[model samples]
Target chain A: MLDLNNIGQRYGKKQVLSDLTHRFESGVSVITGPSGVGKTTLLRLCASAERPSQGEVRWCGEVLSRTPRAFRAGLGYAPQRIDFPEDITGMDFLLHMAALKKIGLREAKSQGRALLDRLGLGRDADGRIRTYSGGMRRRLGLAQAFLGAPDILILDEPTAELDPQTAGHVNDLIFEKDAIVLMTTHLAESLSGRSFATLNIPMAQAD
Target chain B: MTLFFESLATHTRIQLSRHLRSPAIWILALAAPIAARFMLPEQGGDYSIMSINSAYLALDPATIGLQLGVIMAVILTPLAYIFLRAGPTRRQPWQADDLTPARRTAQMLGHWIADTVSLWVLMLVLGLAGVVISLFRLPLSDVRPIVTLLCLCLIAAPALAVIAGLRTIFSTRRGLRGAGGDVLFFFVWLALLLLSSAFFATRSAPPILDVFGFAAPLAGTTTERIESLVIFGPASSGDVLSLDAWSGVMSGDYLFSRLFWLVSVGVLVALFAQIYAPHKFKALRPEIVTTGPPSFSKEPVPLASANGSLISLFLSEIQLVLRPRIMIPVLLIVAAAGVVLPFRGMVGPALALLLTFPFSQQAARWRGMEMSKLSALTPLGSSAVFVRLVAMVVLSTALCLPSLVNITASGATDQMLDIVAIGLGLPLLLTALGYLTRSAVTGRLIALILWYGYLNI
Candidate 1:
């Protein structure tokens, strides 16, 4: 279980999130809000990629920042811009992610192959990442997230910049996974059939 | 600790790491003392040390150390200048966010100040040690000059660092940005830098030297020697300047000078705080930016299309070089140079170097056009690299067309040949070095070193 205890973030004077507190068990959660309500900030905070200015984020009853190695071990994050190192192959990047997540090379190879096949990017695995289309790059972002079977997956606009077919493929992957998933996207109504909770952050009231 | 202080510390540490990572700074910092050790022992280039406490005091370690401080300060300018470009203290600096502009600016300024001071102190310690330790042949008593020199350096370096740091930070403030402000900022910056280095520049009685109190620790000495000294080599054995003469805290004048600089530093700190905070700057306001379009459209381009060819990409690279924003100013500069000295036989290559900068700034783009999926299907192999390099040289040469015509009309074919070689080869060589080092700064620094050597030779 992961929980945020009154977390808040301000970049300069603009308060992005204020007194935001929430908890998530092992299930998919869709974060929705009007544009600029700090949906991405919330996901980033939960992922341990960003430290909230106020309050604390707890993972499995321990503080997230204090136990970073252990906390990040179970967390998978895909930011808005997946800056793929243009030089490396897709397969090599997945393997790099696998190593970063501390997975064994042999297991990483098999898991990498399985995940790529599941994401419909099996054919393009060996190709250089720079050659990948926008939709394909989005799939690779998902592919990296699933590398180590992370318990908490934080994806910021996963369905963004993707074709309908690619978007459908991403939705299937989300429903299929049993991990605690937090995603921010306006087109999430497509997943209406899935048993997922929605968190709507209102506009931050300025002082 | 509060998040504000924590953020300051965290950001400052990162900035320090970045400064330490610069190969130029590291090379110069370490080389300062070693260069001083060897260079100072044999000869005092322009002025000699008349008295050094005693005839046995073989070297005036204080002068060499002070000189080392100046050199180190000069070399530290690159890192200081780096802090001027952008704000620090961000996790994903992909795009500017809805944070208060002032907070980040303040943190960034703090980082620059901390980074500059840390680097200066480190260089001081290392350089001083290098000089003192390398002179192991001399007895501790003979090496007493090192102590006085180190103290002097410590005082001078702080003021120099503060001047450099504040100059960089203040240059970014509201009134001191843009083209006109750039010239003004640079002029003021250079003036302050010179004033801060007054220890070496001015050696006159009061009014002139006394006005620049900050440089006192470096040049605030009153040597009342018995002999009529030309400030030269090998004076009488009895001509020892007393310890009190060289002490950093001797006169009230030095104290007032040091106090003035310290107060000035505090005022700069307050000024930085005032300048970088949010609410005051419109650019740092919070706004929701749509991250591109909601939907994607795919338009496949055939490889045989005009826009898909390598030649088109090369032409596009040339167009990018001639874009009005970058090209107009450069053209004006070249035009002014021509007007100033229309008959100069060597203007062609100099003009070519000026024109090529815009293309070089568009780095990595020329190598492989940042193409869409359908067009970028083929790998941009070695051929594309050659095309990009040649395209830059050709375009640069085209910019130098008038100068080349001038040279041709003058019938100085030998000078024209030199122009061709430099114009065609220099950009290619520098860009290749940039590719090798994975840094444009490396390419720029190497070019600078090459030019310095060329000029000196």
Candidate 2:
């Protein structure tokens, strides 16, 4: 379980998120809102990528700040913006990320190849990431997030640049994964039938 | 420990692969050797170990090794720092590496080791070149080329390692992440070079201060202190003092100093890793804590006014060039120069160095902004670039006015032309290179090498 207890975030003089409290259980939770309502910030907090300004983010029963490395071990995150190193190939980038995740090289190679094939990036895997299209880079990010089979996944707009068929494939993977999955997306209407909690940022912040 | 080694290996492989593929690195690898080969004297030229004579000491392998050691020490620190600055360290957070479960210390040390390995690889290339140059310049029967190569490695390797460690510590540590740190390092290098010079002039300085490990080894070969040493220039008319440089390098003091620096650098890097392991392991900085109560509003931030004349544009460009972070250091340097400018021998060269800083940095920053792409779409078009270039040169010149005034008041007016030439020429050259390569890195790397050369002069 991931818990946000009265968390707030301020950038300079502006408050982006204020007094936002929520708890995520062991299942899929979809976050949706208009742009710039702190949905990505919420996800970043949950992923232990950034600390909340005023309150605590707890993973399981332990505070995320106290043991970020341990929290991160179980957490996989894909940020909205894709700013990969332009000099590296997509496959090498994945392998580098795998090394950070402490995955063995041989296992990472097999799993990374499979992930690339599944995400339709297998043909461009050897090409430099600078050559990758927006959708391809997004898929590469998704593939990295799915690597190591982490216990928690926080993805921001995972299906934004993906095609409809690829987006459907991604939804299926998200739903099938046996982990605490949190994602921010605008496809709430299409995903209406799914067994997941919808946490709207405006509503949550208002409360 | 397993994870530690894994991260180290991963970082080393990634950094090496990235650097190895660069055309600049390849060009430099080829260029440095070829350049050095031409600088050496032709066969049957008089050479000595301690003082450079007619042959510029080319045949003496140990002297060449010592010179190589000192030069590498000067060059590698900034090179490693540039590599780290340009590489993945700047963009790791955006790449999702920030969320890694791996220990921060491990990651930091891994980066340090990776940078060190890159420096060593570069050193090996240059060392091999030195070996080839030495063998080519001297008859095999006249000198033991193998011993010379080993001596070069022995002196230069530890120096490069020390530089790599210092670069890692300075570039990675939080508190030391700005122009102040750069200035501090420049002074440190300058001071060390001065110490080596002093040691060359008077062989009485302690061995431990011999950062290059060059002084003590060469001290025994000649008891007569060298009043002046010239390299790669017209040979001096002094009597040539020839001694076996290999035996001197084998002496106990030189070996101890080399070991001392190597061990000290390793310990210092380890201590830095243990103490300053990034923001993850540390508490949030005070700057992040907003003192005032947080205000909530959906109001959009105000944008800069677009209605501006060419003068206004130039002013704004100057403002960008002298942003507070840059201004503070420039002002500080000006303040220091005010006191030091009266000294006759120091004023001209010191002013030249001071004048060159802003132009080089601005050129590097201008390249980094990639503003050329954005400027093409503006109505002003090329005028905007002209304004920026003029602003950089004029503002950089204005900043040096205090020292320039001092030079004129001291009746050293002739030196003003030299300062102005360097001040104006370097930026134009660097900016041209930036435009040519479309990279912020190449011009800065060339500027760094030129900066070292100026220091030698």
Candidate 3:
């Protein structure tokens, strides 16, 4: 189980989240909320994109503050915005991510190739990412997050900038991952038939 | 025309206001004149142009202004250019609200005018402050020279614009991403322009850039034209009053020449603007396709079998440095220079600088590295990441191996170890400094100083 206990985040004077406490078991947990409601911040905190200002986040009863590097490797994150190296191929980008995760180059290459093929980006593997379409870029972001096979996969606004059909495919791909999935979405109705724990966060109070 | 003028005024005001808030701008603008006034030799035995208005020597009022104007413009233009950038440190993408090419060009001209005027305003204030101080501290007479210098500097507004206009045109042509190169190009071009006027004394044979040179005209004909402005001074008047003998406050007017130079430079600036208007700038800074997936060569990255995490970090950092096309030729040239430059004593220092190049560049290009953010998240500790970054510098600097072998073959062992020490040490120092400061300028400045010192050895 992943636990977010009394987590709060403040950027200067503005409080983005306050006294947020939650526990998540090993399955898909969709965090749904309106904009500026700290959904991304919650996702970030879970992904070790941050350490909570007020309280500790724990994975499997181990406080994330124990060993940050180890904690970070266990967590995979796909940010709301993608700003990857535009000159490299999707395959190359994944291999680099693999290396950052301490995966050996041979395994990184093969695994990276497999991930590309699975994500339907294998044909465009040789092309620079700058040539990638918005949907393709989103898929590549997901592919990169899946690199090194983290135990917890976190994605924020993964369906953004994609058409409904493509968005459905992306959503399906997210659910297909074996890891404990944590995701945020603006369109809660899109997941009407899906069975998962839904966490709703209210809009943050102004400072 | 009203729109153009209006846009111009707005840009000037905006640029000026931005710079006014920066203490860097204030120092760059005002510090020199204040320092010069204080540093000028009290006894004034020196007859150099720099000390013309000093206590011991007195030249014509107009000559004083002309000297101060030229020096002030040279110092302030580049500093102003640095401080005036919208995003000097990082590359900014094109914004929707940006002015159109033609209007932006006009606005840039206005912006340059503002920078020049600001320099004049600050310079006048400092000059007056200095004169008041000089009255008490140094034995001096006549506020006319200081006042006259201020007027001349103000009159040379068009000349300053020529310098600033070239900067604008270059910046527009290169885009914000390449503006740093344009800044360097401006300075180098300035140096060469000054040197060319001396080498090719005959004005008839204009070099490729001499057309632009005539617009600013600081060293060559500009000085000749300005000399006539000091008609009352001994240098221009000659026979009766030697500069040494002239005591009282004296002045002359350069209104006609100032107007002529101003008009001439203004025409060149207008031409420059039209030639490099945003649309034309698109031609100048053509979009480059630098990479195409690198064709996926199966060449081993030297760490396929090495399973250590530190080794992985090293490989990634090296990849970042070698990836850019802009860096490759410079590395090749440095290697070539190391091998081919015939001088014996010069080889070591030159190679030291050469070896430091990639390291310095890597330090500057840290943002692009995978280790930058992910290191904190990965199992690899911060120390391992730091070591790997330093290792990239050490390993890449070994590109000088061929040149190093050549140096040994030529039998210059007196400073061989010393050369190698400096070659390795300079980059390491720069890497640490660059990482600490997160500044490209820091790395470049350290390299410059290191090269300058070792070259003199």
Off by over 4 Å in 3: A82-93, A118-140, A189-192, A204-207, B5-164, B174-180, B183-308, B324-361, B366-375, B381-389, B414-422, B425-457
**Per-residue alpha-carbon lDDT of candidate 1 for residues B1-457, written as tens digits (9 for 90 to 100):** 3667776676566666665665646665676566555434443233334334333223344544543443444444433343333213212231242263425544655555665565465556655664665366345665655554554455455555555455445544545432233334344545655565554445443413332233444344544332232223554454334333245444565656655665566556646655552223222222212234332222221111111345544654454455445666766577446433542333543564454345444343322212211112122223445655777787666555666676677775566555565567667866685454333333443344344334332
- Give a tens-digit lDDT track for model 3, residues B257-315: 44554555556555655654233212132222334421222222221222547666667
Per-prediction TM-score, please? 0.51, 0.57, 0.68
Q: Give the per-residue lDDT digits (tens) of candidate 3, residues A1-207.
A: 789888898888878888878898877899977778788888878877678888888888889877566667667778876566655566766766666677777777876776666555667776667677677788788776776767788888877776675566566666766678999987666667777888888775323
Instruction: Order the candidates by lDDT, highest first.
Output: 2, 3, 1
Please give the range of 10 consecutive residues that has the lowest summed lDDT in model 3 chain B.
B244-253
- In order, the interface RMSDs are 18.1, 23.1, 8.3
For residue B71, give model 3's deviation from the true position in Å. 7.5
Ranking by TM-score: 3, 2, 1
Regions of model 1 farther than 4 Å from truth: A1-207, B1-58, B79-109, B132-140, B145-152, B167-189, B193-202, B205-259, B277-313, B325-340, B343-360, B364-378, B381-389, B408-457
lDDT of 2 by residue, B22-49 (tens): 6656666676677555445453345322
* lDDT digits (tens) for residues A15-131 of candidate 2: 778887889988899998888888988887787666888899888889988976566655667878755645446787676555445555566677778777666666667766656
For residue A93, give model 2's deviation from the true position in Å: 31
TM-score: which candidate is best? 3
Task: Write down the lDDT of every candidate, Cα atoms only.
Answer: 0.56, 0.63, 0.56
Better of 2 and 3 by lDDT: 2
CA lDDT of A9 in candidate 2? 87
TM-score of 2: 0.57
Two-chain complex of model 3, DockQ on C-alpha atoms against the true structure: 0.23
Residue A62's lDDT within candidate 3 is: 89
Q: What is the TM-score of chain A in candidate 3?
A: 0.91
